[model samples]
Target: MVVRTFGISVLVTIASLVVAFIYGSWEAVALCAILGVLEVSLSFDNAVINATVLEKMSEFWQKMFLTVGIIIAVFGMRLLFPLVVVWVTAGLNPVQAFDLALNPPAEGSGQESYEQILTDAHPQIAAFGGMFLFMLFLNFILAERETKWLSWFEKPLATIGKLDQLAVIIAGLSLTLVAEFLADDQHRATIMIAGVLGMITYIAVDGLGSLFHTEQLEEDHERDVASRAAGGPSTLVKATGKAAFFLFLYLEVLDASFSFDGVIGAFAITADPIIIALGLGFIGAMFVRSITVYLVRQGTLSDYRYLEHGAHWAIGALSVILFISIEYHINEIITGLVGVAFIGAAFLSSVVANRREERSDGDSTPKSGGGESPSEMATATD
Candidate 1:
């Protein structure tokens, strides 16, 4: 199962290495390898979060994530998004932007133009992606729910969530505050506009998902009563078709949010867009998808409860980092390590919880040595 899941990743890695070798020398290949590792490490939390949503989706959508979704992640986000950023920031044609990326300015020119263009656009990118991610975290932590990993924080937020659209309010205020941090008037306006767009995108996608929801709808009011009368909790049935489409959209956006950092950080390693796409887009993206699928098939989320919570928390941290990075440059290595630390802590907590449950179950079992139930003693004697 593991090999089957990761087969494409292995192929992608090999193909990227070969492409990198052709692109330049062993040095290029090594850079590709480093970028690939960086991408996978930085996005491990993304895989975990993707699995949390993907598990709720139907099998067909799951397959689509590997096929159609991979194309978007690799080509759309990794390759084309950078060019688009350059184009928008530099006010250059797509061809010119692509050329600039392929052949950067000389080293002694203080900094590479391609990198500088991307850096110039960082404020807008951070505002957009950070707002989107911040909303995701707000929704998760604020939504009214009984299952909570971080009780003190989540409980209060859930209580606040009782007020309708409070997450949006908090998120909007957050964007305004962050925007104020930008000293340049143009940069501040850009952040505000981008932040609003980010919030709008989230609301639009969420509304679309609700609009398309049909599986839980009742044909007759009588049926709902009967369903409620049953002792079991009512199941929220989602229509396979509409639900999958919305889920696919959500997954794509989620992937894009994760890729924003990678796209910018790739410039730090190499100015060549093709190599960046080959390394982070092809190989790294494939590995993340593979991990998502593996987690779903193996029921890893069920086994390690709180993993999703950890991933979301990691996302929240990343979102904060993204916002801070607009004014201050934070190292990609630091970002990656922070995510790993959160995930590792969550994993350890899960392990401890599992052990506690095992001990409780063991203690609850009827023992023959003590005054046990007659049935247990009979079974033991038999």
Candidate 2:
């Protein structure tokens, strides 16, 4: 199962490394490998969140996610998105932006390097991505659920969530505060606008998807009841057509939001666009896709009930880090480790809970009346 899932990612990693070596020798290879690992580690929580969405999609859409989705994630987000950011922020044409990326301005020169332009634009970028992810975390924690990993914390939040649009109000206030204090005077308006747009984008995409999904559920329930009345087999219904398309679109946007930090952080390691694409887009993204599918197929989220909660908490931490990074540069290692710590702790807690449940079930079982239970008899004979 592991090979079936990660085989393509491994092959792509090798290919990307080989290309990196050919492009700039062993140094490029090392940088590419490091960036690939960095992206995977940083985006581990992204995979978990993605699995929760992807499992709702039909098989055809899931296949599209592996194929068409990867293309968009690699070229669109990792490569073209950065170029577009440079073009927009730096006021350069497409060709000029590409050239600037390839031949970055030297340090101490009057002109800024490609990385500098992107970094300078970080306030707006961080505002957009951070707000979008913050909404996701807010909605997750605020919504009531049957299973609670952090019950003491989540229960209060769920009660607070009963207020309509509470997530939006909090997110808006948070964005305003960040733009007012954390952002520079020149970038403040832009940050505010970008953050508002991010919130709108999430609302539109998630809202439309939920609307269609609820309709689908209602239709499915009707069909199920009719089928039962007619004494016919009741078929399962999965999201497809418009419903699945919106879900797919939502997933892509989520991926874009997650990629903002990783793409910007990669520049700290190297300013080469080609190398970054090879490492982050080709290798890192493919592996994330594989991990998402693996989790869905293995039912890992169901087995380890707290894993999704952990991922969302990690996302909340990341959103805060993104805001902090706008004013002060936080190490990518710190960002990645924070996510890993949340996921690891949740996983261990889940293991302990599972064992405790097993022991409770064992103790609660009724004993045979005629004699000692089989297990007790065996122990007595021993």
Candidate 3:
């Protein structure tokens, strides 16, 4: 299953290496490889979070994630999304933007390259992505869940989540604080507008999912259907198509928020759009998708119960970092490591929990096979 899941990633990595080697030197190849690894490490938490949601989706929708979804991640976010950003932010035609990207201006030129222009547009991007991700984390933390990893923090938040629109209010306040940090009126306005749009996108996507909620059949009918499916008569569980569509949209947006850092950081390594797309887009995104599938198929979350909690916490951290980055330059490596640390700690905790459970189960089990204890047998006879 691991081989099958990573098959595309393996192929893409080899292809990226070969292309990099042919295009320049071994140094280029190494850089591409590093970028791919960087992307994976940075977004591992995103993969785990994605799996938690994807597990709720139908198999058809799951398949769509790999097929249609990968295309959007690769082309839409990696390739065309940047072009769109340049076109919109710089007020240039798409063709001109594309050319500028492919052939950026020299360092000595007074005019900035497409990469620099995009970097200059970072405030707006960060606002939009940050707000969206902030709300995502807020909603998760605030909402009531049967399970929790950090009870001290989560318990209070869940209680606070009961207040209507608390998440939105907090997000708005966060934007206000960010606005205060910025000196430029225009940049502040841009950030405010983009952040508002991000919040709206979340509300719209979430509301759309609720609006498309399908009524389930009666319990008797569900039981019969489940029995038939389990008995190998019926084949599949039907999923609500409209709900799936909204979920898919949510996944795409979430993915974009995660990709903003990767896309921008790619310029730090190389300004070549093609290489970024091939390494980060193709190889990195494919591996993320595969990781999501693996988690769902293996029921990893159930086994590692706190993993979801940790991923959300990592997301919250990332969101804060994104917002903070607008005013200060934070290293991409730091951001990635923060996520890694949160998820890694959660994984270690889960391992400890599993071992504890095993010990408890072993202690409770009967020593002899198919036999009652002497005490039990004597009591029964009495």
lDDT winner: 2
- Indicate the residue-level lDDT of 122 in model 2: 91
Q: What TM-score, computed on C-alpha atoms, does each candidate reach?
A: 0.90, 0.96, 0.90
Candidates' RMSD to native: 3.6, 3.0, 3.6
Cα error of candidate 3 at position 187, Å: 0.5
TM-score of 2: 0.96
Off by over 4 Å in 2: 369-382
Q: Model 1 over residues 1-382: C-alpha lDDT tens digits?
A: 9888898799889988998999887988988898889899899999999998888777778888889999999899988898898888778888999888887878897744877888889999988999899999888888877567778888887887989988899998889889886536879998999889988887888678666654434432345567789764565553467766887898899889888888888888887888898889888899989989998899999999988889989999999999998888899999999999988888888899899999999899866667888697789889
Q: What is the lDDT of residue 46 in candidate 3?
A: 90
- What are the per-residue Cα lDDT tens digits for candidate 2 across 241-329? 88899999999999999999999999999989999999999999999999999999999999999999999999999999988877888
Point out the higher-scoring one by lDDT: 2 or 3.
Answer: 2
How many clashes does the backbone of model 3 have? Answer: 0
Pick out the ten consecutive residues of candidate 1 with the lowest summed lDDT.
Answer: 213-222
If ranked by lDDT, best first, what sequence of candidates would result? Answer: 2, 3, 1
